[model samples]
Target: MPRALAARWYSDHDQYQNERRVIWGSEWLMFGVTAELSRPGHYVADEIAGYPLLVVVDPQGELRGFHNVCPHRAGVIQWPGCGQTGNLVCRYHGWAFSWDGSLKSARDFGDSPTPDDHSLRPIRVETWGPLVFVNLDENAPALASTLGSLDTAVRQHAFTDFAYGRRLVRTLECNWKTYVDNYLEGYHVPLLHPLLNSAVDMKTYSVEVPDDTYCIHRAGQVEGSASAGVWVFRYPNLAINVYSDGMNVERIVPLSSTRTAVVYDYFAQDVSEEKIQSMVEMSNITLDEDQTIAELVQRNLDAGVYEAGPLSPRHENALAWFQGRIRQSTGAR
Candidate 1:
């Protein structure tokens, strides 16, 4: 049987630092929705892993991304969250940047203009459906290649019909991996989620890792299909779950070694407000259950009384797959 990752990987400060470098720093991360950048000068600014990110639409109607830091004294271009701006001017200082993230003017540093080399560090920005993503790693593979079969599954489900609805941010007092470990398996559903367990046939519930970068979670069968309630969890931190009328995208971001944030953006197609509210309520209910358990588990992991344990061969294969990728990425023993 495979073993769970050692507890050290969850709460250790050094291990967290290593993860920030090797895993998050190099991976393509979902940033925000494309609807937020519908017009030129509209932008979304936030931090992913450890990088302060900025994704904005230029005058040419193209999406561009940057480090969100002013090259001059490292100030922020915009306040966190979504807003429309006339230009990329540093909020702290007045340094201005061009749409391409090139240095345009240095508020009042000198008489001559600063070179483009001092511009905000540009990153890669791309969109899949309504969501936008950024990659800090200049050498990482394209989002399409990284998504692999997840793309096919998404298209098959007609997930592109989802439009940006609403977003919910939940801060949890646990390692991001702790919640992810909980997400990658269905072992606890029967014991913890009575409502969810009764709705889906547990015997048919399974998590399949068809690609190295993503996994598929299936619970029972839809009327005319092989499965229903299918969700996709991409390696490191992105999750996309599809429902009959809507979908929710999850971005599991690390605020620190011990603190994490779960950002949920809900989307729906031709669905009524009542139905959308019901779906969000269900998600919130399940989230509350998982949060309470995950926080308690995190405390135990940090209590220093445990190290590692055997993983469930039947239910936790996805956990093993996830943990193995962490080990491979971070060189953890």
Candidate 2:
């Protein structure tokens, strides 16, 4: 896919369209890690493509992803978030399911007649490092294969060893793609993020698109200092931003055509608690700036002020590449 075509597609709405039908539909979508669910029967609920989802760890410590809907009465098996429960019970009919999504008990059904096809639909589960991903399409590629060159980048960056520092969610008044576009380029830093401009060297910043699956951007810093930072944009949705002391990674999940909910996690390698607090403060400030600019862009785009925008070869090539990949995935070009 050419950069021009890619940029055009992203601008035209390929991000939301493709994600719902393609990325989240067939490919592996990351949920947290194996450690999050802790005990057997503990479950976390999330949604993708508007379908309710349940992630759980069994007695054997294996993690599984299941449709949160009960097959019997189509009632939701869990709430819209994570929780620990001994058994998944449908609130409507009292159908119970096991940790692995098998039907455990049906409250009201004849002995001869099946209460319902009560089993929960299973989503393919895969684990890498501490992260867990589920493929709604059963035959989709493994998370590692889909990761492409990012597997190496993730390992080299040692994100697996970084402990979770904080998790934050912000609902932004913008299209999800709008926020992603803002993130993919540094063109807005000097203008929208005065604080970030002081922290990151704008002139020395460079983005590397090793393949269609991953894009990495390096932030320039002082020599012989541990101030180097990198941001990895994993194809489709995840953003892995690693700093010297800590790291911040986020996934952009669209709630609607014009609204996005960003799930962010902050991690620290060996930083002190005070430093982590400070990093969190700085991160929030940066995110606030980004959300502000992104919202404005969304408003302008919605108003049709511009049909499309050009990506500068010098500054916006990475965003151009990202847009190109999106076009390729969705057959936009």
Candidate closest to the true structure, highest TM-score: 1
Candidate 1 regions exceeding 4 Å error are 111-114, 221-227
- The positional error of residue 160 in candidate 2, measured at the CA in angstroms, is 1.7
lDDT of 1 by residue, 1-333 (tens): 788898888888899889988888888888887878899889898987677888888888899888888877888999988888888889997987778777788877767564756878889988888878888888888887777778888878778887678778999999999999999999999898876776778898889999788888887753543125578899888898887678888999999999999999888885577766777898887889999999999999989999899998889999999999998988775
True-structure RMSD for candidate 1: 2.0
Score each candidate by Cα lDDT: 0.85, 0.73
Residue pairs in collision within model 1: none
Q: Count clashing residue pairs per candidate.
A: 0, 1
Compared with the true structure, what per-residue lDDT tens digits does model 2 show for residues 295-323? 88777776744556567887787878876
Colliding pairs, model 2:
6-324
